[model samples]
Target: MGVVRAAGAQAAARLTARACRIAGRGATSLPGKVLLRLDPAAIGDLARRLPDGSIVISATNGKTTTAAMTAAILEADGRSAVHNRSGANMAGGIATTLLDARGDIGLLEVDEFWLDGVAAALKPRVTVLGNLFRDQLDRYGELEAIAQRWRVLAQSTVGQLVLNADDPAIAALGRGASSPIYFGVDDSRIGLDAAPHASDATHCGTCGTPFVYERRYLGHLGIYRCDVCATRRPAPSVVAQEVQLDGVSGSRFELVIDRTASIVELPLPGLYNVYNALGAAAAAHALGISMSTIVVGLEAVRPAFGRGESVAIAGRALKILLVKNPAGANEVLRTLSLEGGPLDLLAVLNDQIADGRDVSWIWDADFEGLAPTIGHATCAGTRAAEMALRLKYAGVAPSRITVCEDLPAALGAALDAGMGPLYAMPTYTAMLELRRELVRRGAAGDSFA
Candidate 1:
């Protein structure tokens, strides 16, 4: 049975590679969909080929970034990992990633809904659980429902659960386990004292009463202690301290892992990513990566495409952010607000097959908070005018907003719109479109091959 499965997987990978070549597309999740046509267990088949088992990272946000961090730590420690870095969270994405790797360990970023089935099949050596907030309400339903699903899945996985202790939703999970480790940030300098409007996870997962927070980082992620019955954020087996953000590009922090001390620099940005770095660091330590090797690998890492990724754009630097849902979009806005100066924004909206067919999530995003600070705004994509209208209602001065239905034209107009730095926030498919346009205009690197 195993021999037959290996042969089948080999054939599938070859066929998918051929399709990608012929279609002139960068490696895509569509290949996985192709494999499913042959066998639904195609991802599992691919995973079995990896010798050192795997680690599965899943959440509504930060899966790709977190998985990339773990893979970097592994490679630094001399173990290679097959990963899905293109935001393909389905079974097919998993299949394609595994088939591409020549490594023993598989590091995968999976969708929240796919967790139960994928976890059962891969039987990973470790799993990392980041916080869960309401994202894509139409598709994901509610935060409570998704957390319930994770709890059910955790009950079955035999490996260790590296959970985000600050998230009450995740803190409530993996309770039966005696060996799970938690990783969270403890730097008071970077902590949020009171919960913001975006904050969730206030109630005790154990007691249902509102929990007290010792600190609040973006969106209910921070140190917390329950007063009613003593439920609280677990002290991390690994914790990040003295965090220092180096703009939207990178950060440095001291990681206390299993009692050893090491300073690490991450190639990604945002306070959210600090938690991601800690998760990766803790999980790597559990997997036996030396602190020195982990440090080397993390510093060598680069941002995954469209997630705080910066590229040389026609002699100037442009940062790309994929803003698909509300919670994430709001955080990006908050991050930008800290700049304390005029900012340029390019917001692209598309109601396409890959981007959620519904674009209403834009309203839920706190665009109003982004208005006063937006010195120049250029809206693009097929729904550019729609986005402009939305921004106008959000208090953006109409005079400062420009709508360019043509992507190339919009990007150029946006780049020239404002005086300060440009922030491009596009939806899932719109981001792809913008990338293609950048390629056409000789604005982006041809590293796709």
Candidate 2:
């Protein structure tokens, strides 16, 4: 943990990263792994060098996009950040980001499970806990377990806490915190008629009574209250009102902060993204960023990689929307439902470690809603047959679903079969493979690029 030893570890890690790049491999997390092996406290040591300190953002979904939005806001404010923009959020990724640091501050998107350790190390100026859903049940047990950890983090961290007031599990974390900045959507126009079957947080964390939702938004995120304990969604200082979701193009919402409002034109789709924008705005406000600057930054932000990233392949548009779990997948499907046409899809489902071995969560996702709109669907990845079967069960014609385990071949077939924009919905590893194939074909940039 000494200066000399930390310097030596960083040098070794840098050399390893150079070798990884030479060998045509991603250097995102490997070098950090090497650095940590040499110096276990390297993250803290390097993070301490940043004069402006760090900000940590974590959630089951939208952490990457939220962090990207916050990074854009920082850049608009003429500040530089050492950001893990490559969707790397674990200890290794955080260390690699610190190793390659050249900026005054750190903008880190941490994994939900790793938030505690990284927060302990970075002791960020602001810790943004976006909404958490049931993800990777094999690795991350239950939602309550992560919430308990976050509750501890909220209690122990000295930095300001930015929480989503709509999520009961997340809003409850602010109960003991001194002054948590809460953010949520104030628009009831976009709320679901009723909570979906995939909704995770149905009961109050305090009294174990079922929450009565006045209006349900994405998943369990909505305006809700508990009758037994009187626990309710916190009033958010940062709220998005009069929201307008513009399908795959993006969305617009009134960004309201402390009663003052500004129209924000966010170039990202879905109600889920609205939540992301609210969290980013709240976090930026907590850092003393002006409302005007926040609006400009939100407007300027782009899609974070596979999350709504569009690619041009052989003149046909292919939009990559990542679907990892039930809640996240439901949002993506809901967004797709907004587009006015029969959709062409390249749906890839992988049971990789990163994607979660239990692929049963696909059953919980409301694929039935989007089935009628499918023009032609190409299923690929380790679970291609299973994915195709799910689509068939969801009312997609069996003849319309083509099974191809190979990603490149499936992409080609999907392109050939579709006349319009093709939406590629892939799990974590499948998305990496799909992007790699696109990069190889000169259709897209590298993941880190």
Candidate 3:
């Protein structure tokens, strides 16, 4: 009877998925939502089917790219993993991934807010807790709240843990795990002069006192310590050292696992990506993957969608960097400042449900870094005027900022009236809309599962 019920639920899910596609809607999460409606136990049941079990990755930023990198490494090691590659990372998304899974192990990027529930369901063999930043305040609340919840989840989980030693919030989760593998960037050359205004990790988790930044990088992620409590950043076993960032091209760094060093030429730009690679390598190391395979796979991994994805349009290249919150946007701006020539930008701001309806988060992003190098900028999406205003206050010349509520018009204008490399910075839903527009114009190929 249990087998018959499970088979019936799977059939219903497939039928719903087909219907969604035929109705001009993408078959991403609707099928899973339908399946869960039919069988609440579907995610756990499907996750259990994998012979080698599953792995879960959760973070405010970089989880998608990190998961992709981990999957590439595992695949190179001849272990196939069922991955949630579409970037739909909620419960419905997890269910969809598991329902269509065909691999030895499951590799899932669980949304930070949904991690507890999904972890409860899958009970994965390894749980990778990446950095947590202040994102979607309208939805996820304060960073401390999310950290408190994760601390509980970490304590309850029986799986092996992989954590980012650079992020204080993530590193604190290690206390709950029996044994945790830690990863971070060890190069001081990439450290920031000071923490940005938008930095979230201001206070210590242990003492509630302010943390003294020894070295800050990409917001509050860096070497720090609580002077009062003496709590400091964890020393990571797997670290990236001697890092070099090539604007819009890629990066080069040494991957050090337990003092064993190997040069890794990753094809993704920014110090943020270095963190992603480190997190992926650490997770793979916990699963017994060789360091050689980790290096080879990382060097071959491409940008996941709008996270530095390049799209060519009419003899010029348009680089898309997805920026939804303050910390991630700060990294993109910092990376852009490193480029040689002036930048032409189409910055899109949206207030959709997926992008957090409260658009005040844009004010928190540090756009001041790019003001020096910005050639011409166009703003688009539901809140284009707000973004243009942000640039104006960031010291960009009024003549350099253009506001177009429509994405296509903004993208076209930025390309037509600008010089040098073009950069598109869009919120999550805006990225989807822009991609659809690019596909329509035959500028980008149709995305597949």
Candidate 4:
């Protein structure tokens, strides 16, 4: 009877997927939603079908890109991974990926809030916890709450853990595990003198005392130590050293795996991407993949979805950078600041349920740094006026800021009105909408599973 139910759920999911494809809609989450509705245990059942066992990646940011990088690394070794590459990362999304399973290994990026449930069911062979940040407070509550949940997940898991040592919240989870692989940045040249104001997890996880930063990177991620408990950033076995970031084009860094080092020419911009690459390399190393293969695979990877993804429209290029919270936005803004020039930007802010609904995070981001670089700013989405106001306060003149509630019109104007490089910064839901509009205009390709 149980076998029959499982078969029935898979068949239903397949049918829905077929219909979705026929209807020209991308195969994303609706099929998995139906599958889970039919059989709640469908994820575990399908995950077990993989011969190489499963791997799960969870974080507030960079999970999708990290998962994509990992998949690329495995593919370099002639192995394939069934992944949630389109960024539908909930339970329904996981179920859909399994329903359409075609590879020996299952690589998934699970949502931060859904990590415990998904990990409990899949029991992945290698679980990667990158970092934790204050995101979507209306939905996920506090950062402490998510860290507590991750601690529980880490304790319960029997698999090997791969963690970011720079993040105290993530590093603390290793206390309960037998042996965890820790990865972090070691180069001081790329470090910030002080942490950003939007930085979360400043205090020590063990004690209530605040942490002292030796070298701060994006947000609270960097070298630091607790004066009270003496807890410090773990020396990462996998590290990116002597980093050099080039605007928009890419970044070059030496990927040091243990004592061996290889120069990595990553085609993605920003230091945040370097973190993603290191995490992916560490996870792949835990899975027995060689460092040489990891380096080759990482160099071959492109930006995932709206993350530093470039699209050609009207004979000009439009680069999309998805920013929802302060930390992520700061990194994007910092990257843009690296290219010294007048910039044309189309900023979209959405207050949908997926985007936290509370738009207070915009004020928390340090937009003042890039204010002088703005040539013209076209604000769009549900909270267009609010974004324009935020930019105004950040030092962008009122004459330079234009609010357009319509996304298509705003994008068109930004493209036609600009002479130099154009950038589109949008929240989660806004990215989807922008992509859909681009697809309708034949500017971008459809997303796949």
How many pairs of residues collide in each model? 1, 0, 0, 0
Residue-level lDDT tens digits of model 2 in 1-449: 67898889999999999999999898899999999999999898889888898999998999999999999999999999999999889999999989977998899999999999889988899999898899989989988899888888889863999999999989988998989999998986898976777888889888889999998889999999998888999899999999999999999999999999999899999999999999999989998999999998999999999999999988889999999999999999999999965999999999999999999999999999899999999999999999999999999999999999989999999999978899999999999999999999999987886
Candidate 1, overall lDDT?
0.79
Off by over 4 Å in 2: none
- Model 3: per-residue lDDT, tens digit, 1-449? 28899889889999988898899787878888888888889999999999988989989999999998998898889998989899879999889889977999999999999999999989999998888888988988888888988999999853989898888888888875787888888877888886788787678988899988888877888888999988888899999999999977889999999999999999999998999999889888888888999998898898897788898896779898999788888888888888854788899999998899998887888888788788889999999999999999999998989999999888888889866679999999999999989999999877654
Q: In candidate 4, which residue ranges exceed 4 Å CA deviation?
A: none
- Residue pairs in clash, model 1: 32-92
Q: Model 1, residue 344: what's the lDDT? A: 85
Model number with the top lDDT = 2
CA lDDT scores, all candidates in order: 0.79, 0.92, 0.88, 0.91
In model 3, state the lDDT of residue 55.
88
By lDDT rank, best first, the candidates go 2, 4, 3, 1
Candidate 4 residue pairs in backbone clash: none
Ranking by TM-score: 2, 3, 4, 1
RMSD of 2: 1.0
Error of 3 at 80 (Å): 1.7
**Model 1 agreement with the true structure over 115-211: per-residue lDDT tens digits:** 8888887888889888787766667777788888888888886377888877778877857876788887878898765555555677887778887
Comparison by lDDT, 1 against 3, better one:
3
Q: What does each candidate score in C-alpha RMSD?
A: 2.4, 1.0, 1.2, 1.3
